[model samples]
Target: MSSENDWNEDLCGCMNDGGTCLYGFCCTPCLFGANAEKISEKNCCLMCCLYLVLGSVYLCWVPHYFERQKLREKYNLKSNPSCGDCPTTLLCSPCALCQEARELKARESVQRSALKANNNQPVVSQPEANSGEADHVNMRV
Candidate 1:
């Protein structure tokens, strides 16, 4: 790892998340496309098709390589390879995709928890607000 932050999760740590790992393993194309879509790549289906076709020829690593680089750039993460992400994607495509999915999942949960925490607290100290309905808008009926 360089001065940049390491990836929050390990590549082989894919087993830590069963559903995502299974998804990455069984539907590698979908996983790749989805990861690309999350990082703002347009045409998720196109990406899926690309992965399908390229993967058949064992060249899917090409797109995954660039996608990984984009992800690294997006999050300021350190690339593990001195040669860059190419080798990692070339050698460990499934693990790479699983890692991406887990990263997205983990970040999403963290964000949701953060929002929940924030919503639970008041931004400023203030008197309780009263609904005037209790006083002037009463109906005796």
Candidate 2:
């Protein structure tokens, strides 16, 4: 990991992005699902189902905590001393989800702008075609 980068926004800065804040506030499960999909690069439906199921038993924070860790690692963000991932996700899930979504959006914007500046091409993050499956073929002559 490289030097730690501060979060682009604060946890309670949901109002910064009204759309994301509304989604997270109105439909928490959906928000969690979307964030999980981006963070884990897994099936969106599967992640949504898992979040809904575990949320019933108050265990949704488990996966969310891991996702937060992943975000920290990817951005090389320092851990919050006052409120770690587990506590934040467990206690204030909506805020946490909103923060993660905002961070992802900001990162994507930065990437797109950089690409555009370098070349007049629009580059977007595409999902992996193989979905992590090994590509192999058996050839018999």
Candidate 3:
């Protein structure tokens, strides 16, 4: 192979000529062609993208599995992806929207409790009584 014919074994899997690989399209053939560098670069780029997506899925989503029991014990977090938008199963950050929603719900619950407490109280109409007395006094004047 020439110095410019550097091909990635992983990218193409096995390439016979200087063309694209039949098995692994991400790999470049390193046998001939002046565009060997470009082809190799393209192959490397494809491999990089593949690795990136795989890594993202594995690292981001897979970790939650490893900590499945622990998360469940701690936060009642389960690993069921079908558990309807819970943070433990989701790959996205839960502290953003989920936490915000939980906080908002808690706030609304507190407000509701406060409203219930206020409703339980007996409201006195001192202003109305005072206004009626003022009107009566004005009539006398």
TM per candidate: 0.77, 0.81, 0.27
Candidate 1, 2-67: lDDT as tens digits: 368678888889889999999999999999999999876657899999999998899999989888
Error of 2 at 106 (Å): 0.5
Best by lDDT: 2
Better of 1 and 3 by lDDT: 1
Model 1 bad stretches (over 4 Å): 1-3, 81-83, 123-141
lDDT per residue, candidate 3, 10-109, as tens digits? 2112223222332123321111111221222235444344434645655422322333333233334323343433353244322222222233334457
Superior candidate under lDDT, 2 versus 3: 2
Give the top-scoring candidate (TM-score): 2
Q: What TM-score should be assigned to candidate 3? A: 0.27
At residue 68, candidate 2 shows an lDDT of 88
How much RMSD separates candidate 1 from the native structure?
Answer: 7.2
Which order, best to worst by TM-score?
Answer: 2, 1, 3
